[model samples]
Target: MFIKIIKRTMTIILIIIGLLVISYLLFTNFYPNFGGDIANEQKEVYQKSKQYKDGKFHNTKPVPKDLSFPETLKLAYTFFTTNVPNGRPKEDLKTKKVDSINIANYQGEARMFWFGHSSFLLQMDSKTILLDPMLGKVAAPHPLLGANRFNKEFPLAIEKLPAIDAVIFSHDHYDHLDYGTILKIKDKTKHFYVPLGLGTHLKKWGVHPDKITELDWWQNTVLDGLNLICTPAQHFSGRKFNTSQSTLWCSWVIKSKTENIYFSGDSGYATHFKEIGEQYGPFDLALMECGQYNQMWSDIHMMPEETAQAGLDVKAKKIMPIHWAGFKLALHAWTDPINRVQAKAQELNITLITPKLGEEIIVKDTTNNYPKWWEKY
Candidate 1:
């Protein structure tokens, strides 16, 4: 009887384990948001990249992709149990409405519209380009898994946007490369430029392989005389647990005839910034990452102080902070990133642009005072 009881217990345990394994596999594989697997052909492209090795991409400097499982559990416990002061805005963020007619009729010079977080619509040289356009309401692969964006609306609805000449992606992270946004804009976008292996996700998401152009670090392509260079960034990428760093991650240098702009997709502070600055210095503007960061993950995400230094390292004449005011991905207060970045920028005497969502940020105009908008919320 005791033997039989032990057998039954073992059977129950085995069944639960089997069920969990099945659930995990089903969610990671069947869910479209978990993203695409790297094909052998894409592997060939990745193999040639200096950053790729042992079936994965590695940061130029070694860094933890995420905390250990035990640490993650502990962190999760603290995150929910402890109250973070103003971790999210008490009120919905206010934003400007973008006129699609103005966008379609845009002329004269480059202009940018922030859709909060790292999403931006950049029009330059008679072309419309999207930089990390994660315009979705949530950052997770599924709605139930992530926090809602602080803003109730965007500068312009994604469905109402004008024709897009190109879309540039920094990596395949859910927040930066949203699946839903891709579905909405894929047919409208003429071309997609991404780092190596990221094309696999776009291709799987119904973006024709021809429309996707994947570049290795330091590789560059010109779009109607605009130079788009994929440069090194110290970060990791993985939509699913097992696929971390299977794709490349990097910053970008988008240079037009008269303007050079650097978009730091997601990176920690590193020597790569100096190298990028030396290679492509004197940028007219830089959009730097300055949110969803913590000391425990400092090796992967830059502290607010490091963000200002990175701007200087990239030799940006004017800098704007991004990767905040969209979602609360870290333990810090929602406003902490901008405040800290602002303080550092002031001390360093770096010109900082803090534009409201949907406000027009003219590329060459440095004197326009963007209001301290976040303070209002």
Candidate 2:
């Protein structure tokens, strides 16, 4: 009996070692399998851009917030240990027929289609843009990890996608950007707009030098009639270690000839929202981050009330909450964020638009007569 037990222990240890070796090999080999030397150079340039004339790359007074380490760990434990199942209503979760977006209809104007979980297709005049497009089954690289994606099917697959003028990425976090989705739509995309050094990840995935454009905070890029401005957000970035904050993370301001829209990419409560509003707000619509929130990372992700206040700070005419209802990124009930945001918006006299997955919401004239869509979940 002792000999058999010893043999079993050795076998188990050998199996564990083999798995680790295989995991490392796969990650090193194919993880960043797209970009090459040019991509690395771009990353260096992005790093250099962060420094201000005063010599410090980060010059602004750091925004103060509560991000206690112990609180964060407790939040993580609650999310993992708790078996609470959070998701949209089963009936509402089903994908309705969504036709392809028409750029001609939105010519010289701004329009957006939410594809669930921080992904949106924005059209400004003739320019077609996709923001943090994640058309994958899982947010994490390995299917076994990360939460399942909210919308299982996209209105249009990457291969079937229309000619995309540009793809704007918020950060390198898995939920915000998926490698598999990028691989599929890489060829369809004409240009890539990302914060700081994120191009490294894209180039590693196969994007070319001329196609990638990395920007720093407050930097602006002109695409057709639309101006894509990279604004500051309270968040960090990295797909692996030795790379955290190597790339800048930011929200975006999409301004066209007639309208301006703020995409609050992903951020927690910060006075910067008010600053952003004063600088480039009074927007027609604000797509603020409003999901996957907890006390641990409250400094990085805003709670529902904070999200509603962000809209007011930005002086936005209407608010549509994103970053929730698609994945269980936090411990809150699946419908908690939306439900909270909805009540808060009503109390503040702010118009809230609750769209279905793949629903098209016209910012200029959002029709709110639709039934309480989230209640069905």
Candidate 3:
């Protein structure tokens, strides 16, 4: 009887293990590729970059050493279990809608529309530019796996939007580079500007090769009389479990004859900010990352205080905090980021603009009309 009982227990354990293996295989296989493999031509381009080494890209400044297996497990455990208050709002966030006519009618004046988080519709120099546009309902591999966007609907539907002159990508992370959003807008988008090794992803998604332009850090291109330069950021990149830092990550400097704009694509507080300021200072506006930060990975994402300082470092005439009020990617309350950064900006006497989602802010308008929209929630 004892022998029979032991045999049954061992058989049950084996069957359970087999089932788990099958489940994992199915999940990975069926899920989107996120991006496909790097082609030989792209690989040749990557080889020319000074940052590419061994088989992956490296940050200008090194990140904290890789976490030990036990440490990584602990971090994962904490992330899965922690419940952050106000991490998500109880109701859909209020947003203003702009029709396509107004967007296309703007003659030569610079205007910007925020779509929450890091996505923005920037019209400057008579060109329409979309930045880090992840317009999907969820910021994850699948809708069921991650947090939903704060708003149920965007200010304008993708189909109704005016033709896009350019779509600028900061990196390949899911929140910033969404597959569903790209598929919906690709036909209408005229050009795509991405970091090194990222064109492969676009190619896999059916974007024509002629429309894609890949840039390494410090590289600049002239697009419709605007100078679009890829700058450095202290961050990592990967869409899947095993491919971290395979592609470069970057901030952007968009300079025209009349205006200079800096978009701080997700970054930790680093000296690169000062370097950028020296190279391209006194920006008309700087969109700095200010949310989804934790101490464990502080090297990759800046704290609120650091975000304010980054604005100063970039010599921005006006600063606007972004990368918050959209998704709950970290442990802090959803409101914590804006609140803290606003306080710091006030202390530093820095000019900060806190626009409501979907609200259009004329680049030349320096007046403070933005309300504390997040406080009511």
Candidate 4:
């Protein structure tokens, strides 16, 4: 009877393990949010890239990403359990509604509308382009798996957004490349410019292959007099468990007839900033990454001071902080990024623009002093 009881216990354990394995397989395979799998043909193409190695892509300079078992446990524990004061807002952040009619009929100079975080609606030289437009409420594979947006509404609903001339993606991180937002805007989007290997995600999500242009670092494509160049950024990418660094990541340089802009997608403090500035310096405006960072991952994300210095390294005439004011992805205070970066920018004498979410930011208008919007809370 004792022998039989041991056998029953073993059988129950196996059954539970089998169920968990089945659930994981089904979830990963059926879930569209996990993004595309690398095909054999895609692998052959990836292997040709200088950044590609035995099985994955590498940064221009190697970044140490591995944490020890104990470090991993401690990191996870802090991430899951730490109670951060002001990690999120006391109230929903204020916002202004974006009008579609204004977008269609604007005869103004090059302008931008921020949708919070790294998303931007850029209207320049009669073209409408979206930069990392992850305009969803949650920044995770599933809505239930993440926090909701701090502000209840965006400047414009994704469904009501104007027809897009182009979409630019720096990488495939869920916070930057949202599946739901792509599904809604892909039909209206004319072309997509992404780093090498990133088009795989778009194709799987139903974006036409011809509509997607995959570019390597320093490679460029032109659209109606607008030049879009995929530049280098020190970062990594993945949307699912097994796909980390399976795709290339990048920053972008945009040149119109009268305006030059640089968008730093996400990056650590590195020499790539200096290199990019040498190659494409003196940008009229630059959107710099300024949030979701910690020393544990110092090689992948910049601290506030590094952010300010990066703007100078990129030769930006003026800078604006992004990658914040949208999600509470780190333990820092929600306003910490802006507050810290603002101090550094002032010290460095780098003119930084702090625009309210949904406010119109004109490229050449240096006199309009943006209200310190986050201080009210």
lDDT of 3 at 283: 92
Task: Give the lDDT of residue 98 in candidate 2.
Answer: 55
Q: Write the per-residue lDDT of candidate 4 for residues 76-159, one digit (tens) a residue.
A: 789879999999888888888889989977867899999999999999989999999998889999999898978888888888
Candidate 3 residue lDDT tens string, 218-249: 99999989999999999988886556788889
In angstroms, how far off is 262's CA in candidate 1?
0.3
lDDT of each: 0.91, 0.76, 0.89, 0.90
RMSD of each: 1.5, 4.6, 2.2, 2.0
lDDT of 2 by residue, 103-208 (tens): 4345644667778889888877677889999777776657786667666676555666677899999988878888788888889889999987778788778889
Ranking by lDDT: 1, 4, 3, 2
Which of 3 and 4 is the better model by TM-score? 4
Candidate 1: which pairs clash? none
Error of 4 at 345 (Å): 0.6
lDDT of 3: 0.89
Our model 2 lands, by Cα RMSD against the true structure, at 4.6
